[model samples]
Target: MSAPERIPPRSVTTAELLAKGELKVRGQIREASNAVLYCSVSYEGQDAFCVYKPVAGERPLWDFPDGTLAQREVAAYEVSEATGWGLVPPTVLRDGPYGEGMCQLWIESAADSELLALVDDEEPADGWKAIGFAEVGEGRTALLVHADDARLRRLAVLDAVINNADRKGGHLLPEGQDRLYGIDHGVTFNAENKLRTLLWGWAGEPLTGEAVETLTTLRDGLASGGPLATRLAELITAAEVDATRARVDALLASGKHPEPSGEWPAIPWPPV
Candidate 1:
């Protein structure tokens, strides 16, 4: 089958296209744990590729309540937008062919991008940050590392704010030279601490000035009865929203990137 057509730059915003367009499922992204439908959305002659995750297709997890993953995904997008970093693509909660679901604009990752790597050295080289060692094969191990890119550092802060429980390497989508997008956020925003991720390179390090500024913005946006808090209240539980605010406050108070709590696995399984 022919691949879905890419969405070109257009006058209409991607969020509008996703929210109002007619979505036709092109195929199923079988690799995803939940139902991820590759689809094409069109409205007023404008067309774009998107992923639609219907709420009915969600798989129940022991920790998270059932039938809420799709809303969480949308909440993550809202938080991403509040940061003003645009780290997440345009996403909306809309009714699709299958039913109400989360629809997000598709991003075509750059094939030549190299954000992650495994090296034999015990420590990472300059310009690279070490995650930790991983078993590569029989009787061999390698140091897992990711690029010391500012984009990733921003994402790490975002993850911390959202309590992102699964920030695997595969979820990092590098687009052009300057843009990177993170996906698969359905497992985020738990009331408890569940910040599993591979972006631990800056753990315990002081937050950059930019990060502090952005986080302050997030804190204000998440204040009680604030615009962002009001929006998030619709998607996640009141407790979860309050927890998210507390996380932002903690980050701002400490003024440092968080380290592994050791209560949960630092990195996700199938790291890449």
Candidate 2:
């Protein structure tokens, strides 16, 4: 007899599914050296898609300790939530196909949507901001640009506060009409100044009143020894946690977007 047809599970909110899901690895993301998997997570008979990165699959870095990237991913989510920007998707630390690691709800966007795109000999389009120009083949330079939306600006602020070391162009994902999602936050919250990204358009710009207020709230939340601070400690070193607090303080004091200090490369290679 033929096998019975399978049934799909019901859908639920991203937060609800991530909190109680039973993760099952379905396929491997071969492009990533680290063992990243595309997973189907079912919770309370509701289904969700997630990206699972196991601790065991993490590759060691000279600067970052081993097996801590998963923790960093979860920590990034906490920061996103604490800032109330909801930039990072719902992510949790859990045992999965390979081992304990970060399991984040996968955000869906338009198949043809390009969060960051390269343009040549074209004026700035409406609703878009030119970040910089990059060299293409044959001595051609292309303008690198991203959506000039408030949601992305909020993410830039979040990246500054978290001391994100890598914010490649591809990290931004379009959600709804006016929403953007940020991912790949495993290299964040370092003790040193490692802010690298393609969001230079807002450099030196003063923080909006609302942005400053949100950051102030984040600062107070971390200082009060709230859940965010406690969770960060479990994922990263105490020194790194301290550094995070310090970064928040610095941002509040400056009250403006930070500029590249030239200590490290200001942008990630393969900008996209």
Candidate 3:
């Protein structure tokens, strides 16, 4: 079976959905700068959050086929599951009146303290308390301070190779005080997308023993006949995976800590 999106309903096209069922607006729960309105979809007493991107004016940053976003996200989560990494739920696709957008699975996430509290004092964050690295002030520089931290750094490296662009402040969570859950990896592993987000601070650095082990496992897992290769291919090109693996191999060989490449301080902001 395909990886379940943890959704209230299975995938469907917007037009078909509207024709067959009625969507009771669950009120605007979230908003992006698009014509899209994220509404809770209802069908036969089932409900899920459906993002409707009305076909209209064009935005510079938004260049994706909206309908496919859900499928791409679904594929990413499936692959991440193979590696035991926690990314977000997949977006569900359906043809709509305006155009094809996505129905995203809801995530019950809180802003991580290690990510949000340190970045903005006014931002009241209630997520992910640091157990060992308690002294770290905020996430802006937490990547620097936690450079040597085992789990945090491992997440950083894993995201880097995956080319995650939206590893935002709220996308990470702590499970049972130890495991780190990373989510919303839709904008990753595309060749043209060199998105640098808040998570790039640890690039060019040496991998920790644990990080190295994880990378190594990822490497072998993406090989021919390997378990995750099929999933990785869906999120990235074969060439892309090859490049990512090469970078990982280089990091392992160096046996040094991370340093910024100084190429670009960051990728474009508000990556669609």
Candidate 4:
């Protein structure tokens, strides 16, 4: 089967697309724990592509309730939009061929971009920042590296705020110049310190002026019972929403990049 075209699926309202889009499953992602499908959605005489993860296909997790992953993906988009970072692509919780699922806008990353790896011997070349190191196996270690891009730095901040438990190497997509977009936010906002990621590069660095301002704005917005909170409440428990609020406060209080607490796994399993 031919792959779906790399189309930018933004433009129309999410609700309108969800109601009108005719979803045709193109293929399944066998690597995902749950049923993940690439699909073509036609709506209002326009065609777009999306990644769909149905609630019924979700594998049960001990920490999270059953069938909440798809909504969590939508919640991540809400937070991303509220912060004005646009780190996450436009996403919506809509019914698809596999039933209710998260439908996200397709992003076509620049072909030249490479998957960053944490290496030990290699000094970070230009455009790469050394984050931290991990034990590979048999006492061998590797240094975690990331692109030295400001947008990605901002995404690191957003990951902390969301308590993202899975910031894999493959999640960061580079597009148009230095733009970075983050995806696969199914395991977020667990009302616990579940921030497993490879973004420890700025572990002790002070927050950039823009990051502080954006975080401050988000905190205030959530406190005022704003649209972000309303949208999150529809997907997650009230406790989890309150936890997200607390996380924002904690980041602001620290005023610097967070260090791994050693309470949970610092990096996600498989890294990518």
Ranking by lDDT: 1, 4, 2, 3
lDDT of 1 by residue, 154-221 (tens): 99999999999999999999999999999999999999999999999999999999999999998888
Clashing pairs in 2: none
- Which candidate has the top score in lDDT? 1
Q: What is the C-alpha lDDT of each candidate?
A: 0.94, 0.83, 0.51, 0.84
Cα lDDT tens digits, model 4, 137-250, are 998988778877788789999999888999998788889786789999999999878889888777878999999999999998778477778878898888998999998898
RMSD of 4: 6.7
lDDT per residue as tens, model 2, 65-170: 7348888999999989998788998998887757688889888875566667778856658877777778888999888887777887898899998888889877
TM-score of each: 0.95, 0.89, 0.57, 0.89
As for candidate 1, its clashing pairs are: none
Candidate 3 regions exceeding 4 Å error are 1-30, 33-72, 87-104, 111-114, 117-151, 173-180, 192-195, 200-205, 255-258, 267-272
TM-score of candidate 2 versus the correct structure, residues matched by position: 0.89
How many collisions per candidate? 0, 0, 15, 3
lDDT (Cα) of model 3: 0.51
For TM-score, the strongest prediction is 1
Model 3: per-residue lDDT, tens digit, 174-229? 54445566655556665443545555444555566766676677778777767677
